[model samples]
Target: MIRTERIDLEPAFVLHSRRYRETSLLIEAFGHDSGRLAVVARGALRPKSRMRGLLQPFIPLLISWRGRGELATLTAAEAQGEIVPTQGSATLIGFYVNELLLHFLHRHDPEPDLFETYRRTLQRIALEEDPEPSLRIFEKRLLQATGYALQLEREAKSGARIVPDARYIYRPDSGPEPWDPRRHSGAGISGETLLALSEERLSKRDTLREAKQLMRRVIFAHSGEKTLISRNLWRRRRSSDAA
Candidate 1:
Protein backbone atom coordinates (compact mmCIF):
# COMPACT_ATOMS: atom_id res chain seq x y z
CA MET A 1 0.00 0.00 0.00
CA ILE A 2 1.22 3.47 -0.94
CA ARG A 3 1.20 5.83 2.04
CA THR A 4 0.35 9.49 1.48
CA GLU A 5 2.35 12.44 2.71
CA ARG A 6 1.30 15.91 3.86
CA ILE A 7 -1.92 16.00 5.88
CA ASP A 8 -2.91 19.62 6.39
CA LEU A 9 -4.51 21.13 9.49
CA GLU A 10 -6.41 18.00 10.44
CA PRO A 11 -8.58 18.02 13.55
CA ALA A 12 -6.97 15.77 16.17
CA PHE A 13 -6.39 14.82 19.79
CA VAL A 14 -3.06 13.83 21.32
CA LEU A 15 -3.52 10.28 22.54
CA HIS A 16 0.05 9.87 23.80
CA SER A 17 3.51 11.39 23.32
CA ARG A 18 7.03 10.56 24.40
CA ARG A 19 10.56 11.84 23.90
CA TYR A 20 12.31 10.77 20.73
CA ARG A 21 16.08 11.18 20.44
CA GLU A 22 17.45 14.56 21.63
CA THR A 23 14.53 16.96 21.39
CA SER A 24 11.97 15.37 19.08
CA LEU A 25 8.78 13.61 20.16
CA LEU A 26 6.94 10.51 18.95
CA ILE A 27 3.25 11.41 19.00
CA GLU A 28 0.37 8.98 18.84
CA ALA A 29 -2.77 10.91 17.98
CA PHE A 30 -6.38 10.39 16.92
CA GLY A 31 -7.18 12.39 13.78
CA HIS A 32 -10.71 12.98 12.59
CA ASP A 33 -9.94 12.29 8.93
CA SER A 34 -6.69 10.34 9.06
CA GLY A 35 -7.52 8.02 11.95
CA ARG A 36 -5.02 7.01 14.62
CA LEU A 37 -1.54 8.18 13.57
CA ALA A 38 2.07 8.04 14.70
CA VAL A 39 3.75 11.42 14.33
CA VAL A 40 7.17 12.78 15.03
CA ALA A 41 7.32 16.28 16.41
CA ARG A 42 10.69 17.72 15.54
CA GLY A 43 12.24 19.74 18.37
CA ALA A 44 9.14 19.37 20.54
CA LEU A 45 11.22 19.07 23.69
CA ARG A 46 13.03 22.38 23.23
CA PRO A 47 12.38 25.26 25.61
CA LYS A 48 10.88 27.35 22.78
CA SER A 49 8.81 24.53 21.23
CA ARG A 50 5.25 25.87 21.12
CA MET A 51 3.83 22.46 20.17
CA ARG A 52 5.21 20.91 23.33
CA GLY A 53 2.45 22.53 25.34
CA LEU A 54 -0.25 22.11 22.71
CA LEU A 55 0.43 18.37 22.29
CA GLN A 56 -1.00 17.44 25.67
CA PRO A 57 -3.94 15.02 25.85
CA PHE A 58 -7.63 16.20 25.86
CA ILE A 59 -6.82 19.40 23.90
CA PRO A 60 -8.34 19.83 20.45
CA LEU A 61 -5.79 20.58 17.74
CA LEU A 62 -5.59 21.51 14.07
CA ILE A 63 -2.34 20.10 12.82
CA SER A 64 -0.23 19.66 9.68
CA TRP A 65 2.18 16.83 9.05
CA ARG A 66 4.42 15.30 6.39
CA GLY A 67 6.42 12.12 5.64
CA ARG A 68 5.14 8.59 5.09
CA GLY A 69 5.31 4.95 6.19
CA GLU A 70 5.05 3.94 9.86
CA LEU A 71 5.65 7.49 11.13
CA ALA A 72 5.00 11.06 9.95
CA THR A 73 6.58 14.37 10.87
CA LEU A 74 4.42 16.94 12.65
CA THR A 75 4.92 20.34 11.02
CA ALA A 76 2.44 22.62 12.73
CA ALA A 77 -0.14 22.32 15.51
CA GLU A 78 -2.66 25.00 16.52
CA ALA A 79 -4.92 24.82 19.53
CA GLN A 80 -8.58 25.10 18.62
CA GLY A 81 -11.18 26.68 20.92
CA GLU A 82 -10.82 26.86 24.70
CA ILE A 83 -9.45 23.69 26.28
CA VAL A 84 -12.05 21.85 28.34
CA PRO A 85 -10.74 21.36 31.85
CA THR A 86 -11.16 18.18 33.92
CA GLN A 87 -10.32 18.17 37.59
CA GLY A 88 -9.41 15.50 40.15
CA SER A 89 -11.42 12.33 39.50
CA ALA A 90 -12.73 13.64 36.21
CA THR A 91 -9.17 14.10 35.07
CA LEU A 92 -8.38 10.50 35.94
CA ILE A 93 -11.43 9.27 34.04
CA GLY A 94 -10.42 11.37 31.07
CA PHE A 95 -7.04 9.64 31.02
CA TYR A 96 -8.84 6.33 31.29
CA VAL A 97 -10.68 7.12 28.05
CA ASN A 98 -7.40 8.05 26.38
CA GLU A 99 -5.89 4.76 27.47
CA LEU A 100 -8.83 2.92 25.95
CA LEU A 101 -8.41 4.74 22.63
CA LEU A 102 -4.74 3.88 22.50
CA HIS A 103 -5.40 0.23 23.22
CA PHE A 104 -8.59 -0.43 21.25
CA LEU A 105 -8.32 1.72 18.13
CA HIS A 106 -6.17 0.60 15.23
CA ARG A 107 -3.58 2.95 13.86
CA HIS A 108 -4.44 4.45 10.44
CA ASP A 109 -8.07 3.39 10.75
CA PRO A 110 -10.56 6.23 10.38
CA GLU A 111 -13.22 6.33 13.05
CA PRO A 112 -14.30 9.94 12.75
CA ASP A 113 -17.52 9.31 14.59
CA LEU A 114 -15.72 7.81 17.58
CA PHE A 115 -13.25 10.69 17.50
CA GLU A 116 -16.12 13.19 17.69
CA THR A 117 -17.77 11.17 20.43
CA TYR A 118 -14.56 11.36 22.48
CA ARG A 119 -14.42 15.14 22.08
CA ARG A 120 -18.00 15.58 23.25
CA THR A 121 -17.51 13.19 26.15
CA LEU A 122 -14.61 15.29 27.42
CA GLN A 123 -16.72 18.41 27.09
CA ARG A 124 -19.58 16.85 29.05
CA ILE A 125 -17.19 15.48 31.68
CA ALA A 126 -15.87 18.99 32.22
CA LEU A 127 -19.32 20.38 33.07
CA GLU A 128 -20.91 17.43 34.84
CA GLU A 129 -20.76 16.94 38.61
CA ASP A 130 -20.58 13.15 38.26
CA PRO A 131 -18.26 11.59 35.68
CA GLU A 132 -19.68 8.08 36.16
CA PRO A 133 -22.46 8.46 33.61
CA SER A 134 -20.11 9.81 30.99
CA LEU A 135 -17.60 7.08 31.75
CA ARG A 136 -20.24 4.37 31.37
CA ILE A 137 -21.46 5.78 28.07
CA PHE A 138 -17.94 6.12 26.72
CA GLU A 139 -17.08 2.53 27.58
CA LYS A 140 -20.25 1.24 25.94
CA ARG A 141 -19.72 3.30 22.80
CA LEU A 142 -16.06 2.45 22.56
CA LEU A 143 -16.83 -1.25 22.60
CA GLN A 144 -19.55 -0.78 20.00
CA ALA A 145 -17.36 1.35 17.78
CA THR A 146 -14.62 -1.24 17.93
CA GLY A 147 -16.97 -4.04 16.76
CA TYR A 148 -17.52 -5.55 20.23
CA ALA A 149 -21.10 -4.34 20.69
CA LEU A 150 -23.07 -6.28 23.26
CA GLN A 151 -26.36 -8.08 22.79
CA LEU A 152 -28.10 -5.92 25.29
CA GLU A 153 -31.78 -6.27 24.43
CA ARG A 154 -31.99 -9.98 23.60
CA GLU A 155 -30.73 -13.48 24.29
CA ALA A 156 -28.32 -15.20 21.90
CA LYS A 157 -30.01 -18.54 22.32
CA SER A 158 -33.74 -17.87 22.64
CA GLY A 159 -33.71 -14.62 20.61
CA ALA A 160 -36.03 -12.91 23.03
CA ARG A 161 -36.04 -9.25 24.01
CA ILE A 162 -34.71 -8.69 27.48
CA VAL A 163 -37.29 -8.55 30.23
CA PRO A 164 -36.36 -5.72 32.56
CA ASP A 165 -37.11 -7.57 35.79
CA ALA A 166 -35.51 -10.85 34.75
CA ARG A 167 -32.05 -12.07 35.67
CA TYR A 168 -29.42 -12.84 33.01
CA ILE A 169 -25.79 -13.73 32.43
CA TYR A 170 -23.58 -11.98 29.88
CA ARG A 171 -21.14 -14.58 28.60
CA PRO A 172 -17.96 -13.12 27.12
CA ASP A 173 -17.72 -15.75 24.40
CA SER A 174 -21.44 -15.56 23.68
CA GLY A 175 -23.74 -12.79 24.97
CA PRO A 176 -26.59 -12.12 27.35
CA GLU A 177 -28.50 -15.27 28.30
CA PRO A 178 -31.64 -15.44 30.38
CA TRP A 179 -30.96 -17.16 33.68
CA ASP A 180 -33.03 -20.23 34.41
CA PRO A 181 -34.65 -20.03 37.79
CA ARG A 182 -33.70 -23.70 38.31
CA ARG A 183 -29.92 -23.29 37.89
CA HIS A 184 -28.49 -20.43 40.00
CA SER A 185 -25.18 -18.96 38.83
CA GLY A 186 -22.87 -16.01 39.38
CA ALA A 187 -22.94 -14.55 35.84
CA GLY A 188 -26.54 -13.39 36.23
CA ILE A 189 -27.23 -9.68 35.82
CA SER A 190 -30.46 -7.67 35.74
CA GLY A 191 -32.23 -7.23 32.42
CA GLU A 192 -33.19 -3.74 33.53
CA THR A 193 -29.51 -2.96 33.92
CA LEU A 194 -28.74 -4.36 30.48
CA LEU A 195 -31.50 -2.26 28.93
CA ALA A 196 -30.29 0.88 30.63
CA LEU A 197 -26.73 0.25 29.42
CA SER A 198 -27.84 -0.63 25.92
CA GLU A 199 -29.82 2.61 25.70
CA GLU A 200 -26.93 4.52 27.29
CA ARG A 201 -29.16 5.89 30.02
CA LEU A 202 -28.28 5.62 33.72
CA SER A 203 -31.03 7.28 35.68
CA LYS A 204 -30.52 5.53 38.98
CA ARG A 205 -27.46 5.05 41.18
CA ASP A 206 -27.72 1.26 40.93
CA THR A 207 -27.82 1.52 37.16
CA LEU A 208 -24.53 3.39 37.24
CA ARG A 209 -22.97 0.77 39.49
CA GLU A 210 -24.23 -2.10 37.37
CA ALA A 211 -23.08 -0.40 34.20
CA LYS A 212 -19.54 -0.23 35.59
CA GLN A 213 -19.53 -3.93 36.38
CA LEU A 214 -20.80 -4.77 32.88
CA MET A 215 -18.28 -2.55 31.13
CA ARG A 216 -15.42 -3.98 33.20
CA ARG A 217 -16.22 -7.53 32.19
CA VAL A 218 -16.81 -6.63 28.54
CA ILE A 219 -13.64 -4.56 28.31
CA PHE A 220 -11.53 -7.16 30.08
CA ALA A 221 -12.76 -9.92 27.78
CA HIS A 222 -11.70 -8.12 24.60
CA SER A 223 -8.77 -5.98 25.75
CA GLY A 224 -6.22 -8.76 24.99
CA GLU A 225 -3.03 -8.17 26.99
CA LYS A 226 -3.23 -4.41 27.41
CA THR A 227 -3.70 -3.45 31.03
CA LEU A 228 -5.80 -0.44 32.03
CA ILE A 229 -3.34 1.66 33.99
CA SER A 230 -5.77 4.50 34.52
CA ARG A 231 -8.25 2.10 36.13
CA ASN A 232 -5.63 0.79 38.52
CA LEU A 233 -4.55 4.30 39.42
CA TRP A 234 -8.13 5.35 39.96
CA ARG A 235 -8.67 2.34 42.23
CA ARG A 236 -5.67 3.32 44.32
CA ARG A 237 -6.87 6.90 44.50
CA ARG A 238 -10.31 5.78 45.65
CA SER A 239 -8.73 3.54 48.30
CA SER A 240 -6.66 6.44 49.57
CA ASP A 241 -9.67 8.72 49.55
CA ALA A 242 -11.66 6.17 51.53
CA ALA A 243 -8.80 5.70 53.98
Candidate 2:
Protein backbone atom coordinates (compact mmCIF):
# COMPACT_ATOMS: atom_id res chain seq x y z
CA MET A 1 0.00 0.00 0.00
CA ILE A 2 1.29 3.48 -0.87
CA ARG A 3 1.58 5.98 1.95
CA THR A 4 -0.07 9.30 1.29
CA GLU A 5 1.76 12.59 1.76
CA ARG A 6 -0.22 15.24 3.56
CA ILE A 7 0.25 18.97 4.18
CA ASP A 8 -2.04 21.37 6.02
CA LEU A 9 -2.45 25.15 5.96
CA GLU A 10 0.69 25.68 3.92
CA PRO A 11 1.39 29.20 2.72
CA ALA A 12 1.15 29.17 -1.07
CA PHE A 13 0.35 31.13 -4.18
CA VAL A 14 -1.53 29.90 -7.20
CA LEU A 15 0.93 30.09 -10.05
CA HIS A 16 -1.49 28.83 -12.67
CA SER A 17 -4.87 27.12 -12.90
CA ARG A 18 -7.04 25.46 -15.53
CA ARG A 19 -10.40 23.78 -15.93
CA TYR A 20 -10.31 20.14 -14.98
CA ARG A 21 -12.81 17.52 -16.17
CA GLU A 22 -16.40 18.65 -15.68
CA THR A 23 -16.53 20.55 -12.41
CA SER A 24 -12.98 20.70 -11.05
CA LEU A 25 -9.99 22.99 -11.43
CA LEU A 26 -6.39 21.94 -11.78
CA ILE A 27 -4.01 24.23 -9.93
CA GLU A 28 -0.26 24.66 -9.97
CA ALA A 29 0.70 25.91 -6.53
CA PHE A 30 3.98 27.37 -5.30
CA GLY A 31 4.08 26.57 -1.64
CA HIS A 32 6.49 28.16 0.78
CA ASP A 33 7.80 24.77 1.80
CA SER A 34 6.50 22.23 -0.73
CA GLY A 35 7.64 24.24 -3.76
CA ARG A 36 5.79 23.64 -7.00
CA LEU A 37 3.05 20.99 -7.08
CA ALA A 38 -0.22 20.15 -8.80
CA VAL A 39 -3.48 19.79 -6.90
CA VAL A 40 -6.95 19.23 -8.28
CA ALA A 41 -9.84 21.14 -6.70
CA ARG A 42 -12.80 18.90 -7.11
CA GLY A 43 -16.14 20.56 -7.89
CA ALA A 44 -14.58 24.03 -7.94
CA LEU A 45 -16.69 25.01 -10.92
CA ARG A 46 -20.00 24.58 -9.17
CA PRO A 47 -22.04 27.78 -8.94
CA LYS A 48 -21.80 28.05 -5.17
CA SER A 49 -18.30 26.70 -4.68
CA ARG A 50 -16.37 28.51 -1.93
CA MET A 51 -13.21 28.73 -4.06
CA ARG A 52 -14.90 30.59 -6.89
CA GLY A 53 -12.68 33.68 -6.90
CA LEU A 54 -10.11 32.57 -4.33
CA LEU A 55 -7.91 30.38 -6.53
CA GLN A 56 -6.04 32.94 -8.61
CA PRO A 57 -2.45 33.82 -9.35
CA PHE A 58 -0.72 36.27 -6.97
CA ILE A 59 -3.17 35.90 -4.13
CA PRO A 60 -1.81 34.84 -0.75
CA LEU A 61 -3.44 31.57 0.32
CA LEU A 62 -3.27 28.81 2.87
CA ILE A 63 -3.78 25.49 1.13
CA SER A 64 -4.06 21.86 2.20
CA TRP A 65 -3.51 18.68 0.17
CA ARG A 66 -2.97 14.94 0.34
CA GLY A 67 -2.02 12.27 -2.17
CA ARG A 68 -0.06 9.12 -2.89
CA GLY A 69 0.83 10.12 -6.45
CA GLU A 70 2.05 13.14 -8.40
CA LEU A 71 -1.27 14.93 -8.56
CA ALA A 72 -2.71 15.64 -5.10
CA THR A 73 -6.23 16.57 -4.15
CA LEU A 74 -6.77 20.12 -2.89
CA THR A 75 -8.62 19.63 0.36
CA ALA A 76 -9.00 23.25 1.39
CA ALA A 77 -8.00 26.84 0.45
CA GLU A 78 -8.32 30.07 2.41
CA ALA A 79 -7.19 33.61 1.68
CA GLN A 80 -4.49 34.74 4.02
CA GLY A 81 -5.69 38.35 4.02
CA GLU A 82 -7.24 41.08 1.88
CA ILE A 83 -6.48 40.64 -1.81
CA VAL A 84 -4.25 43.27 -3.35
CA PRO A 85 -4.78 42.93 -7.06
CA THR A 86 -1.96 43.44 -9.57
CA GLN A 87 -3.20 45.92 -12.18
CA GLY A 88 -2.27 47.50 -15.54
CA SER A 89 1.32 46.88 -16.69
CA ALA A 90 2.07 45.11 -13.44
CA THR A 91 -0.25 42.33 -14.52
CA LEU A 92 1.95 41.48 -17.48
CA ILE A 93 5.06 41.71 -15.33
CA GLY A 94 3.36 39.46 -12.79
CA PHE A 95 2.73 36.89 -15.50
CA TYR A 96 6.33 37.19 -16.59
CA VAL A 97 7.48 36.48 -13.04
CA ASN A 98 5.12 33.51 -12.80
CA GLU A 99 6.42 32.18 -16.09
CA LEU A 100 9.97 32.38 -14.79
CA LEU A 101 9.04 30.37 -11.71
CA LEU A 102 7.24 27.78 -13.85
CA HIS A 103 10.19 27.41 -16.19
CA PHE A 104 13.05 27.44 -13.71
CA LEU A 105 11.77 25.63 -10.64
CA HIS A 106 11.71 21.85 -10.40
CA ARG A 107 8.74 20.13 -8.79
CA HIS A 108 9.12 19.35 -5.06
CA ASP A 109 12.28 21.49 -4.70
CA PRO A 110 11.67 24.07 -2.01
CA GLU A 111 13.78 27.21 -1.54
CA PRO A 112 12.20 29.26 1.25
CA ASP A 113 14.35 32.30 0.51
CA LEU A 114 13.38 32.15 -3.14
CA PHE A 115 9.72 31.95 -2.13
CA GLU A 116 10.09 35.13 -0.09
CA THR A 117 11.87 36.76 -2.99
CA TYR A 118 8.94 35.89 -5.24
CA ARG A 119 6.43 37.30 -2.78
CA ARG A 120 8.37 40.54 -2.35
CA THR A 121 8.74 40.83 -6.12
CA LEU A 122 4.98 40.70 -6.64
CA GLN A 123 4.43 43.30 -3.93
CA ARG A 124 7.08 45.56 -5.42
CA ILE A 125 5.61 45.24 -8.91
CA ALA A 126 2.15 46.12 -7.66
CA LEU A 127 3.46 49.31 -6.06
CA GLU A 128 5.99 50.57 -8.58
CA GLU A 129 5.21 52.16 -11.93
CA ASP A 130 8.45 50.97 -13.49
CA PRO A 131 8.59 47.32 -12.52
CA GLU A 132 11.70 46.62 -14.57
CA PRO A 133 14.03 46.95 -11.61
CA SER A 134 12.04 44.39 -9.63
CA LEU A 135 11.97 42.09 -12.64
CA ARG A 136 15.74 42.34 -13.08
CA ILE A 137 16.32 41.73 -9.39
CA PHE A 138 13.99 38.73 -9.45
CA GLU A 139 15.88 37.27 -12.41
CA LYS A 140 19.16 37.69 -10.63
CA ARG A 141 17.90 36.09 -7.43
CA LEU A 142 16.23 33.27 -9.34
CA LEU A 143 19.50 32.53 -11.08
CA GLN A 144 21.29 32.50 -7.76
CA ALA A 145 18.76 30.22 -6.13
CA THR A 146 18.74 27.77 -9.05
CA GLY A 147 22.56 27.34 -9.20
CA TYR A 148 23.10 29.68 -12.15
CA ALA A 149 24.14 32.80 -10.20
CA LEU A 150 25.98 35.47 -12.22
CA GLN A 151 29.30 36.96 -11.13
CA LEU A 152 28.72 40.68 -11.47
CA GLU A 153 31.66 42.23 -9.64
CA ARG A 154 34.44 39.95 -10.87
CA GLU A 155 36.00 39.35 -14.26
CA ALA A 156 35.66 35.92 -15.87
CA LYS A 157 39.43 36.06 -16.34
CA SER A 158 42.34 37.67 -14.44
CA GLY A 159 40.28 37.61 -11.18
CA ALA A 160 40.02 41.38 -11.16
CA ARG A 161 37.28 43.49 -9.58
CA ILE A 162 35.03 45.39 -11.99
CA VAL A 163 35.91 49.07 -12.53
CA PRO A 164 32.94 51.39 -12.94
CA ASP A 165 34.46 53.36 -15.84
CA ALA A 166 35.35 50.41 -18.04
CA ARG A 167 33.12 48.37 -20.32
CA TYR A 168 32.67 44.60 -20.31
CA ILE A 169 31.02 41.90 -22.36
CA TYR A 170 28.99 39.37 -20.41
CA ARG A 171 28.74 35.73 -21.38
CA PRO A 172 25.98 33.83 -19.55
CA ASP A 173 28.05 30.83 -18.58
CA SER A 174 31.43 32.58 -18.22
CA GLY A 175 30.52 35.82 -16.44
CA PRO A 176 31.85 39.23 -17.52
CA GLU A 177 35.15 40.03 -19.24
CA PRO A 178 36.82 43.31 -20.17
CA TRP A 179 35.36 44.33 -23.53
CA ASP A 180 37.64 44.29 -26.55
CA PRO A 181 35.67 45.57 -29.52
CA ARG A 182 38.19 43.93 -31.82
CA ARG A 183 37.13 40.45 -30.62
CA HIS A 184 33.87 40.76 -28.69
CA SER A 185 30.68 40.24 -30.76
CA GLY A 186 28.02 40.78 -28.12
CA ALA A 187 26.94 44.18 -26.74
CA GLY A 188 29.30 45.85 -24.28
CA ILE A 189 27.97 46.84 -20.85
CA SER A 190 29.43 49.56 -18.65
CA GLY A 191 30.90 48.61 -15.27
CA GLU A 192 28.41 50.95 -13.59
CA THR A 193 25.50 48.79 -14.66
CA LEU A 194 27.23 45.63 -13.49
CA LEU A 195 27.95 47.01 -10.06
CA ALA A 196 24.44 48.40 -9.74
CA LEU A 197 23.00 45.01 -10.58
CA SER A 198 25.45 43.30 -8.23
CA GLU A 199 24.11 45.40 -5.39
CA GLU A 200 20.48 45.43 -6.58
CA ARG A 201 20.49 49.25 -6.75
CA LEU A 202 19.35 49.73 -10.32
CA SER A 203 17.82 53.25 -10.73
CA LYS A 204 19.48 55.48 -13.31
CA ARG A 205 18.16 55.35 -16.86
CA ASP A 206 21.33 53.89 -18.33
CA THR A 207 21.79 51.39 -15.52
CA LEU A 208 18.22 50.13 -15.88
CA ARG A 209 18.56 49.84 -19.67
CA GLU A 210 21.79 47.86 -19.53
CA ALA A 211 20.53 45.70 -16.67
CA LYS A 212 17.44 44.79 -18.68
CA GLN A 213 19.56 43.82 -21.70
CA LEU A 214 21.98 41.74 -19.63
CA MET A 215 19.34 39.88 -17.60
CA ARG A 216 17.27 39.11 -20.70
CA ARG A 217 20.26 37.61 -22.51
CA VAL A 218 21.39 35.52 -19.54
CA ILE A 219 17.88 34.19 -18.82
CA PHE A 220 17.37 33.20 -22.47
CA ALA A 221 20.78 31.53 -22.62
CA HIS A 222 19.89 29.41 -19.60
CA SER A 223 16.27 28.71 -20.62
CA GLY A 224 17.13 27.06 -23.94
CA GLU A 225 14.46 27.22 -26.68
CA LYS A 226 11.47 27.88 -24.44
CA THR A 227 9.75 31.12 -25.35
CA LEU A 228 7.95 33.15 -22.67
CA ILE A 229 4.32 33.81 -23.57
CA SER A 230 4.16 36.96 -21.43
CA ARG A 231 7.14 38.43 -23.28
CA ASN A 232 5.58 37.67 -26.67
CA LEU A 233 2.34 39.28 -25.57
CA TRP A 234 4.17 42.38 -24.33
CA ARG A 235 6.09 42.61 -27.60
CA ARG A 236 2.93 42.35 -29.64
CA ARG A 237 1.30 45.03 -27.56
CA ARG A 238 4.28 47.31 -28.11
CA SER A 239 4.19 46.71 -31.84
CA SER A 240 0.49 47.40 -32.03
CA ASP A 241 0.87 50.59 -30.02
CA ALA A 242 3.62 51.76 -32.35
CA ALA A 243 1.63 50.89 -35.46
Name the candidate that leads on TM-score: 2
Candidate 1 per-residue lDDT over residues 96-143, each given as its tens digit = 999999889988889999988899999988888887888888888888
Q: CA lDDT of each candidate?
A: 0.88, 0.91
* Model 2: residue 105 alpha-carbon error in angstroms: 0.3
Residues 1-243 of candidate 2 have per-residue lDDT tens digits of 999999999999999999999999999989999999999999988889998888999899999999977799999999997565798778888989999998899889998999999999999899987888888999999999998999999999887999999999998999999999899886699999999999999899999999999998899999985779999988987888899
The collision pairs in model 2 are none
Q: How well does each candidate superpose onto the true structure, as a TM-score?
A: 0.95, 0.96
Pairs that collide, model 1: none
Off by over 4 Å in 2: none
Q: Which one wins on lDDT?
A: 2
List candidate 1 segments past 4 Å from native.
Answer: 1-3, 181-184
As a whole number from 0 to 100, the lDDT of residue 187 in candidate 2 is 61
